[model samples]
Target chain A: MSAIGDGRSMPTGAGLFDLPPELAIDTDVARRVIAEFVRGQLRQAGFERAIVGLSGGIDSALVAYLVAEAIGAERLLCLMLPYRTSASSSRTDAETVVERLGCAGELVEISPMVDAYFGRPDTGLVGAAGPEGLTASAVRRGNVMARIRMTVLYDRSVTWGGLVVGTSNKTEALIGYTTIFGDAASALNPIGDLYKSQVRQVAAAIGVPETIIRKAPSADLWPGQTDETEAGFSYPELDRLLFWLVDRRRSVEELEAKGFAPGLVQWALKAIAGSEFKRQVAPIAKLGPRTAGVDYLYPRRRPGSART
Target chain B: MQPLRIALAQTAPRLGLLDENLASHHALIGQARAGGAGLVVFPELGLTGYLLQDLAAEVAMRLDDPRLLELAAATASDGPAGLSAIVSFVEESADHRLFIAVALLEDGRVRHVQRKLFLPTYGLFDERRFFAAGDLLRATPSRLGVGVGLTVCEDFWHLGVPQLLALDGAQLLVNVSSSPGRDLAALNEIGLGTATSWRMLLRTYAQLTTSFVVFVNRVGVDESISFWGGSEVIGPNGEAVFSAPLYDEGLYFVDVDLGDVRRERIALPLLRDERLELAVRELNRIVSERAGQADDSTSEPGAEPGLDVAAR
Candidate 1:
């Protein structure tokens, strides 16, 4: 019932991160499996290079490191796409990752694209939405920003000939914190299964800069925005609740008995249920005799499906 | 008595590519023979890969397929130690029923075929939905001078399979698998919960059956699931003879003494003391009771749909 750091070989700088006892994994084994998984995915698809949307946040930074480790850093391209309101410190943190990994990094400012649709109040420029769009809600603008970044990444992928690797973790995907078809789209996701707290644990182990790992996790959609403050729950507590409820198949009553607040458990359950559609493929109406993803099931990488 | 060298081909098969995988098997068999291995084992569906939803039919081969015969011919080619290789693939019956099968090759021919018995249908496995479940379980004599039993992944999950194989006079039990890796947590010795579970099962079955248990699992990604290839060889006394690294693609060799089975069986005598009649009688009573056939049937009136039929 003890964590890995207690009796087993503690990872280097393990004390720097706060990992839940149950979420603490052997970093070595995780790296090995992920390296193989990343390589296998790329090999099956017949792609030699991979592109990652590198936010200064820990999740994407960890993904960049993993891709660099799996395939050589020479083949990895980290795109830092930031909006005008994004914190300057976030860009600095991303630069540190690129410097340490010695991988290709590009700065793609998304303000022009975003402002073109939402309009710019400062320059008094009227875009597609005119004056009304300038005063859009932070949520609407955040979704636009995410989709714009996705657009840029896919557009660049055509030129780079690299697959887009996903950075969203299990915690975000389960709670539906991602913008569907925006940030959630990827050719393959390696760490979509790791919780946020577990993401931090792996980030620390995989040599993500300590400042980035220790910094407050945020979407950087706006100034002073943070995920924990927005979600209203610490990741460790939320992850533990999710572990019992989803992974262990514990009933809400059992989760309450295990000392999780009933209200928190109920809210978490709601989020997971509401976000269910984002996790799977959109179902096709079963009108035909044989439908793809229905009766005509086939593996993603069939014989001729690989990129020749 | 010479120690038998087993070559565990922990390969990563291309998803739904039959000819490419067939070529790999042919080369690996020759390599294993050149290395002086008497026995070589490949993972379940190594010839056609796992996660082949509708592609199963496209890659399936019949028992009389010339490609299978040619692959078998690679095992015994005038080598000092004639090779006995257990290769797995999708089998197409005369009636066109697709089945996951394992064939034992010796003397340049298909010696015996063991179709996979338990088709796991729950969780990530959609096997039973596509392939037919095998009906027979028997041990065959091998060129290794001992009785051999062959099984697929989920076949060993049932406790009765290994026991039945051992009772049928098998000294070496071989299980080929394409088991997907999931359930990662800090609770297990290894980071993988699946590997932890499989490792425990291999050791336990080895000791209980008093037989050498050899497990060969594939390594590769099929869609979302990645197969963990921690292939292992367990001795008769539940000790690990050798363990291949997880997720690494290579041909690994392990030397196991066939005499160890005799030594452990005589010392433990667990198999000898097994009461087959008692188990059969209890099984029959339970089956009849569950079916509401016996007078002492404990089933409720509507517990099972067949109870009314039993009453009629």
Candidate 2:
């Protein structure tokens, strides 16, 4: 959606995707900062390796690329978590990334894990949810699949001796579009601060496959499910709105004046406010004088906190 | 006259580890000494890393502390080999209030101590919640044959700090920082917006104050923040003599002729022409008006105290 050679877009020849002028970052600087962040997180936590859930989408693909860029590809493990309903192209695209980066890649199907909870409608598989899971909505099934992926990643985190890297972007995170303790769970997130369009720019810069970058972003929960269609908006427009509303701290009047629809602006504001809890730690009752997040404050990994 | 050799110790301090950071300072000082550095500057809280919420107490040191004495002992010489160093740390007063203090070490002793005046409390900063602000500022004589003024990170952010230092006959102004990098929008030429802003401020201070500006910002990750190390040396005319690479930890030596201060000051005469009494009178009036103790001449009729606008 953007033309090349403008002050905003990526400093490359032709634009790979749309990038909001305000969201346009120096990709070189972003890579350097992210590289340091990835290394810093691993070093602070006494980790030598990192794990990333690669969905073949731009977000996960870019995260995998960044993690691999920070620590060598040899130190990175790319897990392709696919449900039974997940598209075959997702696996192929994920495999392309692994092959390109030469990092360790594995395909772990979450179908059995998901089916055991949600049950199979065609077969008489009485899942743990009794008969209720058989009639479970797609939303419930998607959530279970996401959590199942998280379980596999964490279990492998022990065996692989690597921390899981998050793949959620700012646009989706602000909209409450992520599954808590599921795909949103990570030891550290490198790309959570970037918008979706910005993720594509980074993905393109980092040599993620063009096919993956151009393809419609989807959760791959079901067939023919694209994120834009489901969310009812394009990523460029959504990313721009979030940048102005959240990062720039623009008011409702200011945003409406900037040419966004009043209804759309109201909707985005509501979504940001509604998702506030998903973005923060659960609050304690503060019965104790020095609670963990209250009066007693400490950095996550202090001197003695790092693993020996 | 030979240019003064300054070593910028752009280091990555260990979070909450005083012994380790002190060891690093000692090692870097030895390196600076060997490199013939007349003065070496370390970033703010270089002895104890930035982002120490409760660990400020555990790492705070008094001026008479033996550990500080040992670090100052390295500067014990009166000859040309005598090294003057500026190092920052958490200073605990007898009253138990901790302040972010920078000390000028000369002739094996603490020559001067300047505590940070401004503590940024908003955005990603929480300095005011933990440490107390200093109430004084002065330029002290240094072994390098120049009056040197020292300031911590936020102190230089105030326009008054640099101006007052220059007015007090400071030929060199040094600001030590643990500034975290943010605002990565590409409109900034320096990649990081914080870096760009600091660059502009340092150059402007150097040119306006007609003094050499030395900025040493720390590098490393303490918590979620990464301090971008873009330490620099600006001449009296605002030209950069040296700029250390961003985010690289190294002890860099930058040589600058202190005589440029004399030449630029004589040519510009901005500091000499400064009307200090006029500024003082106006500032006092503004303060009183804001405090509701005096009428604000700029205020409209029926305006509330501290408010300049009145309802029609």
Candidate 3:
């Protein structure tokens, strides 16, 4: 039976209350459910081909596998982008993912190109002025690399008539671990809603490589840098706190009741509240009577129109 | 021919609160259904909320996310005369990119999804930072016999997407938007008719294309940004059929006859007289000139304008 039919057949009237008696935490079932939904969306959007940037990381690996399962390997293109700071093993991990997924892929080394532009003594050292100079420098450098990669992706998208797919998960997105207009760009994303922990569950169900799945999440922007280390909190703790505060809409006191550290809850709330600007359209002055994001409002579509 | 009843949901979304926003949508959908609305439309990015900058990538969901599925099931169960609505959200792509997306749900399943094709990079609209622009511009086939062209906020402002959809035989044009209020004071100071200019643009498109136009916008405040919700419906003659209140979240319903669109187009005959071949030739000439200009001004190599085809 088709996945849509499978979804439709699953009793809906029960709402969230009617959990099956033996509701096992089946990540595979969830993956299939998510994949089916994404696939249906692509079909609805009239897109058959999908292009993805394959970083040697769990998030990208999981997204690639899901896309393969959803739309098939034949319709997916995995672009492996390795930068100067990238580990040799990163390439191998990416290759293994493409092989396992049986998808077509191309390796693009961004070192020579990145070095030529930013490695120059004059331009490269602008952001690298202090003791923690390299961190800032690497960020600027990473932005260039990310934009370059997107340029390539868009070029390929035009050539192949495919949509560029995104791989960012919920955890990284919460703390602004992504570069604006760089790694954060795509025509659609499938894993953005899943937290890091949730992504691992989905990855394991899809048989993603353990090397990627188990490794500490990092942007691979600079040497010896890890995401959790940079964020100052691990994904498990962060995800748990975020789920409660953002998803559950619980207050600081409610979080304390749930046994979360007061400081941690405060920290999470502050961080989320602080980063609120990153979540919206650019602010505009009210010039007209009806402006988008300002005074214009509508639901998506109304019901019962002419159907062909 | 029966008049097509339409409702617009013009409201701002609370960031990252999926369940709460979904609940709000459900209530609106229920109201639209009960009011005998054949179709309802919401503002852009209504699901996750607009101004979700990077959060769009994080909270973006697949069309089948349980929340969406729940919505679909509700629509299906509420059926055959039940309300169908177009809901917008950020959708994650296979490569981990996000798209400003709109999905049409009828009988509890998504009928079609259209991604925003134009990513405005200037001013405060840094859509290029998050969403990858869409390529296809064809009208999606809806259950309602007529082809419906779905364009998000920015896409309708451009001629390319709307024109392409019209050429492809879209009988109705629906633009879902999350446009934030900007520089109204500047317009007043400068004595510029920005609001009237905007109305003229919408009216011209409706009249020229000889298609019914439905523009839905979001309202409410997110941080310092306030959305001006001016949801409106225009007939084939470029007349305002129905308009919702500004700066508020409310439902505005209108009835339209598809036959009028055909009759208007027949009367106008602009669509029939469009100079497709000459337009392509002019575009090529402009591109060639731009390429020559780029080579001449090689010092400013970064000034190359992105190639954009005007669809409408």
User: Which candidate leads the pack in TM-score?
Assistant: 2
lDDT of 1 by residue, A1-308 (tens): 23355476543335665677777676777877788888888888889999999889899999999999999999999999988898999999999999999999999999999999989978878889888998889889989999889989999888888999999999999999999988998988989989988888888878899899888889888788899899898888999899888888999888989999988998898999999999999999999899998999887877777798
Model with the higher TM-score, candidate 1 or 2: 2
> Cα deviation in Å at residue A237, candidate 1?
0.6
Candidate 1 regions off by >4 Å? A1-7, A10-15, B297-312
Residues B161-188, model 3: lDDT tens digits: 7777888888788999887654222112
The C-alpha lDDT values of all candidates are 0.89, 0.89, 0.73
TM-score of chain B of each: 0.95, 0.96, 0.87
TM-score, chain B, model 2, is 0.96
Docking class of 2: medium
Clashing pairs in 1: none
Q: lDDT tens digits, residues A88-137, model 2? A: 99999999999999999998988888888778987978798999989999
DockQ of 3: 0.01
lDDT for model 3? 0.73
Residues B3-53 of candidate 1 have per-residue lDDT tens digits of 999999999998888899999998999889889899999999999999999
Give the range where candidate 1 chain A is weakest over 10 consecutive residues by summed lDDT: A1-10
Off by over 4 Å in 3: A1-308, B77-82, B185-194, B288-312
Q: What tens-digit string does per-residue lDDT give for candidate 3 at A1-308?
A: 11333343222112212222112123533454456445544543457888899888988898898888878899999999897668777888999998998888987787666665554443445332443333446668777888888878888887776778888787777867777667788777777767777677667657888778778788788777798788788777778777777766788888899888888777777776776665555788989988765656322211111122
For every prediction, compared with the true complex, DockQ reads 0.59, 0.61, 0.01
